[model samples]
Target: MANSLPVAVLFGVYLGIVTGIVPALVAWTLGFLFRYVVGVTIPGFGVLVLGISLAGVNGGLLALADPTIVATTDAPTIVTALLVVMMLTLYAHSRGDALGAALPRGAVAWRAIGERTLSVDLAEVFGSEVRIAVEGPVSDIEGFPPLSADTRTAIRETDWRLSADLPIDELQRRLADRIATEFDCAEVSVQIDDRGRASVAAAPELAGVSRRLDAGQRAVSVDALVPTGLVRGDRVTVRTPAETVDGTIVSARSGDPDEPSTAEPVPHSGAATTTGGEGRVTVGVSRADASRLLAVDRAAVIVRSRGRSREIELLSVLRRAGHRVRSVTLGADPPATVADLPGTVLAAETPDGWTITPAADHPLAPDQALFVVGSPETLARLGEVAR
Candidate 1:
């Protein structure tokens, strides 16, 4: 009826049908005024009269549109036709509620639609989803909950691939940075394979610090820039109040001139602070030499020995098969570090507690709660083995 009708006629009929609203509103206003001024109740006779008149006119129009035939056109026939058409119209409208109620439920899927919309948005931006494969010790992923030991172990043991519709390189760098910064690995490798898969590998070792301290010892922040000509590996002497220690310079950093030097230690371990921007140079020395140099105040130094790079592997197969880290309690016969506990590394004891970097070198003590990293199967084995 709506499609076949003239737009102008339909609009006029709509206006006429809604005109009864004015009289109803006026009736309400008059009723309130009558109650206050005349001190008498005003039953809403005005709106009731408008409602009946509107209904009669609407039925008269519907009756004319009805196709029921009569032997002769008469008032009684028209009145009966209007009543029957109105009844049928009302019955159909009533059934609409039941039809709606009969529809199937979709609570679970409907609730998940919000999450699915995010994937759709990503697809619109990136041509295809980027796949990531992280193979290392990591506590969590950005969008995921804190990883469990079982989850981590499963990841390590297998090439677990996750998909995201984001820039490949950016996602790769973000993962690598988080793992390296959190795990305190000496070196991390981030690469993309031919299949557009981003892979990450980290070398988790507390021993890396020991090796650096041993190879060349003096790690001090100095007030003066060591001569630019004296590069890394040149033997240098740093003077302290107590004594002077001599060692090869493993590294040198001229503190940023723009970034004012505050009285703070450098980020690395065994760091010392000096006042003022003139505190430009940092030098590395041997562990033996560092003992003496650390005792004295850093003063202008002179240099002798040559230094060389330690052959540390950039990437190695994850020993735990890419599993997550877990903590377990130690029983009487705690396994030793030399036992080659596959997929498991004894990190810390209850006495020492947890740390950002796992202290894998320590031996398990009896009844000490321990944090261990490995694949799920290995961790399960360790639980039995440690006991």
Candidate 2:
């Protein structure tokens, strides 16, 4: 039976209070627990929808049980009940969220429930103690030539001890210097890892008499009787029937071509042998003097006496003062002149030859290299600018 509008409205409000309001309260309780206990949020609209669904089921059950009790099952009555539940659910959920945010975190409750709290110390994790040592034979770096077998073996056999606190870049540099000096390498590149492994790429120093040649110097071999105890780098004067030519002995081997050449100058004592022997002695001399020396088939060599050199002393002093010499190659668009560089230009190697202590304004070309002397900091800055 259809009821009056006032009675129908009253029955709808009562039905909403019994079914919708209770379900809305249950939904609000679930939202509050999720936010405060689990540290997660349940949307107010989700709770509202759930409460409306529960209210529809409750209303359907009430109608099935007794059709006369509901008084009205119209769309307006159902919408009104759903609206009431939605507003109340949304309001309660918002209040729950506010309370959850205002309270302290749920870690205390977790501890009370016998769950462990996870914590990490960043410094302890990242700041590990470093221990550096030479582990095995040094390997080659890519894009560079490999080191000789002898050099690699020597480096591996030697006892290398580095400070555990040294930076990686410093370690690499010191290792490179040590390898270059001990093994007589012309070029060296070093890389080291945190595990104390080293990779070394090196080029052996060029061998033979041509490496010692300077600008305007020529090596000419002549059939001559060299003075006894004569070795490479000794100043000598060759006397022929026509003229006398001054030169430095590059190599002197008596008849035996397989004998090893010696460059170290040996001291002459009173008991030393003085007799001259027939051999082919390669002498480094000026272009004009080389022509004169080469024209003669036979000559007699007289060793010239020399005093101590000051250049070696200067180099030692400079090394003790922490000065270093580093070579840098220029690119296509290089710095204008020697003056534009950071460190002092000791010398510059050009297509022509080497220029010692070149002037400030000397022009630089592509692929030319400059030997600079400075502290490590200056050299590093120069490298950055060059790159």
Candidate 3:
């Protein structure tokens, strides 16, 4: 009976109650979020109110159009039908409504809206529906939770529940400027937790000065817009600070601290009221290299520090093939077996595996794969003779 006619009718009735609410709740939330979150003035509040009224009127008219009303024997049949529907709902719920088990769950999918009537599966969203929030002003959503970038990209529900990562506080600050352009709130608002579950809070708070400062540089870091595939061990030189890569991409980086650097040392003597904190820093040079790092943009300054030196980092640079006596390394090494110690160089080629030679330049890292390259005779000879 869950997917049967009775269940569908129940679903429709439930839809009626919520569909009756969709426009009003949406309009109010949208308009309210717009004024409060986006902080922009928009004309949709009137349209929302009107649309809600229209939807309610239309829903009521549709309800009245039911032919069963005319077929009823008693005068109270209309209300009686409604009450009976309610009683059946309670009965089904008591029986663990099988149809209700098939309803949608979790966050709303904003893109799905304007296509389907949201909340058709009432129990799916009745107490736990995904909220599609038209983000707006702090004042608009006085009690709603703030939005964040982390939350927005993860939204995946039919409700188009209004937000991804847009924390409540942020929605209020940024909502207004959006309406005039999109004629709709550009973003949505939702609250998410660490386990990836999303649910609604009563309100998003306004951002105060202290909050802004608290969220200051990290917020900028969070949305830094840095190029992808940026990893650790990368030969990074600042493009904005200067036009060159620090070590010119000798090795690609692949590790932690992926945020943009805000390493400018604070000044004690700059004017207290100064707005633009502009200064010059020159890095990695014996004066000549410093000039090389600096180009024309005075706005771009190289950051200097004590150990900001430039040199080839040769822990494990590259493998040499088709050309090798022993092994290449940071320092020269004496001839010895590859198993001798830390600086042993591995000789190339043979049936009997090649042994590493002890050398001064041998790289220190243990995980380095032995690179062998050279003429066949020389390779075979070393493979046979080097011990």
TM-score per model over all chains: 0.24, 0.36, 0.16
Following a full C-alpha superposition, what root-mean-square deviation does model 1 have from the true structure? 23.3
lDDT of 1: 0.46
Query: lDDT, candidate 2, residue 48?
Result: 76
Evaluated at residue 260, the lDDT of candidate 3 is 63
Q: Residue 372 deviation, candidate 3, in Å?
A: 46
Q: Which structure among the candidates has the greatest lDDT?
A: 2
TM-score, ranked from best to worst: 2, 1, 3
**lDDT preference between candidates 2 and 3, better one:** 2
- Give the backbone clash total of model 1: 21
Question: Who wins the TM-score comparison?
Answer: 2
Candidate 2 runs further than 4 Å off: 1-189, 193-197, 202-218, 223-234, 252-280, 286-298, 303-309, 321-387
For model 2, what is the error of residue 245's alpha carbon versus the real structure, in angstroms, after optimal superposition?
A: 1.5
The TM-score measured for candidate 2 stands at 0.36
- Clash tally, candidates in order: 21, 0, 81
Candidate 3 — which residues are off by over 4 angstroms? 1-19, 41-49, 68-387
Flag regions of model 1 displaced more than 4 Å. 1-193, 201-211, 215-222, 229-234, 239-244, 250-252, 256-277, 280-292, 303-387
